[model samples]
Structure formats: C-alpha cells, structure tokens
Target: MPRFFSNKRLIILLVGVIILVALIGFSLRDRERVTLPEQLIKDAAGVGQEVFSKPAGFVSGMIGQADLLLDSYAENKRLKARLADYAAIRSEVAALRTENEELRKVIGKQESLRAYNPIQATVIGRNPDQWEDRLILDKGANAGIAENMAVMTADGLIGKVTLVTPLTATVELLTSAGTDYRVSALVQSGSGEIHGLIEGYDAERGELLLKRIPSEFDIQPGQQVISSGLGGIFPKGLVIGEITEVTTDEFALTKMAYVKPAAEFPMLDHVMIADRIAPEIEPVELRPESGEAAE
Candidate 1:
C-alpha cells in the first residue's frame, strides 16, 4: 500500500468505469428485458418522433388542400357565370312566350269581332283602388273610341268604355260592384223566351244579376243569355253568360237570375274595342227655304 501507487480515489474511479461497462454489456445481452432507465429514454424518443411526425403530416395535408382550392377557384367562377347566363336565357324565353300568348289573344278577339270594326287596344294603367272595376286603355276618341263602347276580350265582353281622353280611354267593368249601368239582355233559347235587364252585380259570387223579368215564365238553368239590343246601347247576339239559377226577387214580384261573365277580368292585358256596331248616319240638314219645310 504505497501512497502514490495505490490512491483510494483512483481505484474507486476505475472500479466505477468497469462496473458501468459490465452493466451495458449485460443490458445488451438481455435486450428484451430492458432496464427502467433505457425504457424511459426509448419512450421519450418515441414521443418526440410522434410530435414531430404529426405536425409534418398536418402541414402536408393543409398544403395539398390549399392547392386544390386555388385550382378550383377559376372553375367555380366559370360555373357561376354560366348559371347567370342560363337564368337570363330562361327569363328571355318566358318573356317571348308571354308576348306570343298576348298576340294570339288579340288576333282571336279581332276575328270574333269581324262583323263590327274592332280596334285593338292595350291595357296601359290599372289603379289598385279600382283594379277589378276599371282599366285604362291605349285607344281613345282619335281611334274612333267613344264612351259606352263595349270592350271585349278574345272570348267575350268584359266592360264598356266609360271615360275617353284624346289618347286613352277608361273602361268600367260589368262586374263593377258600384256599377250604375244596365244592359238589356234576353235568353236565346231558339225562341225569344226570356228577357231581363242586367242591373247589379253580386260581388261575393262575381256574377251579374238580371232583374225585372216576368216571374210567371219558367226560366230554366244553363240557358244562354245574350244582349237583347232593345235599348240600342248594347249590340245583339253578344254572349254574356248562362243562367245559373233563377229565382224570385226580394219583392217576389219579378224574376232574378245570376249570370257569370265570360271574360276573365282584372287579369286582362289586351282587349278589342267595338268601334261601332252600326254605321253612323249623318243627320240631314233641313233649310227653311226648302220645299218640304215651306210646304
């Protein structure tokens, strides 16, 4: 035991190194049974790898999706523009169809009024306050349109011209709730059987009521009623509507019947004006000096 050759501190340090080498060799030999310290190191390394791998995978997925979105942007814009064009085309087609229908109606109306001169008129204005009761037309006195002239649709009569201006005329519907006008009409049943005056309208039922008829006559239903042309205001043979029901009036002295209008009022866009049913006869001027007047 020499002091310099045999140092206790150096001996202890050498033994510690030998023991550390032996432990590492033993751990390698029995690698399946890893020691706690090595197991802890493996787990920490695995956790670090997983943390780094997850972030890398997430970033990669985000970049791929972003590229796809950027590529689709132009295509989406193109699709949107195509949709707008398709919508515009649909609107144009619808407008064309509507115009064709209106034209057809006008033509049919003119044909129906072949006996009388027909003036094609367009509905210009309809006030909501009197939408169903009245309609403003484009034709006026200049077009030979006069007050009390019958206004008709393609199917049948709708109203009568009540007001006329230089360029426009106003029509008062036969179905007007406040209508004071009356039409002389008769039932056309092969024989001139029933005749009555169209006096008022039933607002609830949207029908014209005929009054002042002989209650003794049996006026049956489904009979075709038309203008009698007796008063000379309304023309003859104009189809009004069929007799739906016949009953006694409130006074029980006269007969009353409901007549549905043939015209679809409040939805009309075009109509025909009966310019004149008969030719206007100029009055013959008489002079006082004439032979007939002096004689």
Candidate 2:
C-alpha cells in the first residue's frame, strides 16, 4: 500500500502490538501459584517473621545487658578481698593480750619464792656510782651465793652479799655508810633480848643510824627489830626496823635507837638469799628450888 503507509511500515506495526500486549500480560500473571487463605498464608508468614525477628530481638537485648554488667563487676572484687582478711586478724589478737599479762607477774614471783630457802635472783645492775645504796645480783657461785649471803625481804632485812661473781652479785645496803648492821630484837610482845646496830648517814639521801642499846634495855617507841641469829650473818627472826628514835647520852653508856628499815632500800625490787640454816632447839629441864633444894 503506499509502501505500507511508508515510515517503515508504521514502525513494524507498533512493534507487533507491543509484543502482543506483553504476551497477554505474562499469561495473566503466570506467577499465580496463589492458592492462599491458610489463614492468609499464616498472616503473610507472620509479617515476614516480624521483619527478620526485629534484628534478632535487638541483638538479644544487647547481649543481656552485657552479662549483667559483667556479673556486677565480679561481685565488687570479691568483697574487697574479704575486707582485707578481717584486718589481719585484729592485729594478732592484740599481741597475745600483752604476752599474757607478763606471764601472770612471773607466776606471782614463783609463789613468793616458795616461802624461803631462797636462791633465785635478778636485779641485773644499779650502782652507777653508788645509785642510792648499791644493787646488782643475778645469783652467783652456782646459786649458793656466799660472801655474807643474807639479803632478805618478803618484807624485811635487805643487805649483805657484798660482792661475788660466778654469775654475778653485789649488794651491801643497810643504808651503807661505814655500814654495820647487827640485830637481834625483841619487845613487840616482850620477852627481852634487844641488841641492835645499823648505820649509814647519807649515801645520797638514804640516811640511817640506829645504834647500840643497853641503858637497861627496855627500849620503847613502836618496838620491833628482829634478825638475831647472832652474827651467823642474819637469820633468827628476819624483820629489822620500827623504833624511830630514842636517844640518851648524858655520858654515853649505850642507848641510841633510830631504826626504820623494814626493807625499803630504795624500794629494792626483789630479794631473798637465806639458803636455810636455822634449826637448833634444845632447852628443857626443871624441878629444884625450894631454897635450892636445901642446899
């Protein structure tokens, strides 16, 4: 026809009627495998599995809040290492209660030195140039402490053992000062026996005197003076003091009296050296005096 109406045959007859209406609309939407309604295909596959499980449930709730903040910072560092192990066991129980009260005052001074037969000693040193009446003991001569051993004091006589040393010793104090100290007293309840002497005049404020007595010895003034084993060095009754002054010298015939010792040699801490040796009793025989049995 005019060359099939020319313009290249009307563009190939409108591209073959748009490829026959796109092949009849792709054979009427051929992907129609539609046989739905199983509850609308399980509600469209649960809305596409709730959009891919809402990002895996928000990344599993942010990894469970980072494992509960790393288990609460490992239980706060295990309770600060158990509170520093309870403050180092309360300072070792206060240093074992001050070493058990110094071992109960050294077992109450060994039970008051077993009542006496004594020998135990210890007063290390003193006498840095005569410290108010000497002192220095630690027991000597294998504990038989010689050289005038008598030192006494559970509350009486204190001074003798002027120097020795197998282990150490030295004590000489009855107030020391050209010292002399003999005693053998009586008159607290009276039976008569007084004989006294003790001297010293100021070995740095430790003064003392207490001299001879015999002005018809009945010496009074709170009497009490003990220790009269007669120069066996001391041992007969122990105590030695309490008669504070009773002078008399209109032409001296003996009777001075001052005594006040009863152990206080600068508060002498610990003493006792007796070493036993007092036992000799014998005297009993009577009947004869009706004018001396008719002499």
| Each candidate's clash count | 0, 0
For residues 96-177, what per-residue lDDT tens digits would candidate 2 score against the true structure? 7567557868775332211337776755445767745677665566677876667877788777775564555667777766
TM-score of each: 0.54, 0.25
By TM-score, the best candidate is 1
- Each prediction's RMSD to truth: 40.7, 50.1
Looking at model 2, residue 20 earns an lDDT score of 97
Q: Which ten residues in a row have the lowest lDDT in candidate 1?
A: 279-288
For model 1, how does the per-residue alpha-carbon lDDT over 180-249 read when each residue is reduced to its tens digit? 5677788766555688888888888888898888877777788888776564555566778888888899
Clashing pairs in 2: none
lDDT score of residue 80 within candidate 1: 88
How big is the positional error of residue 153 in model 1, measured in Å on the Cα after superposition? 1.1
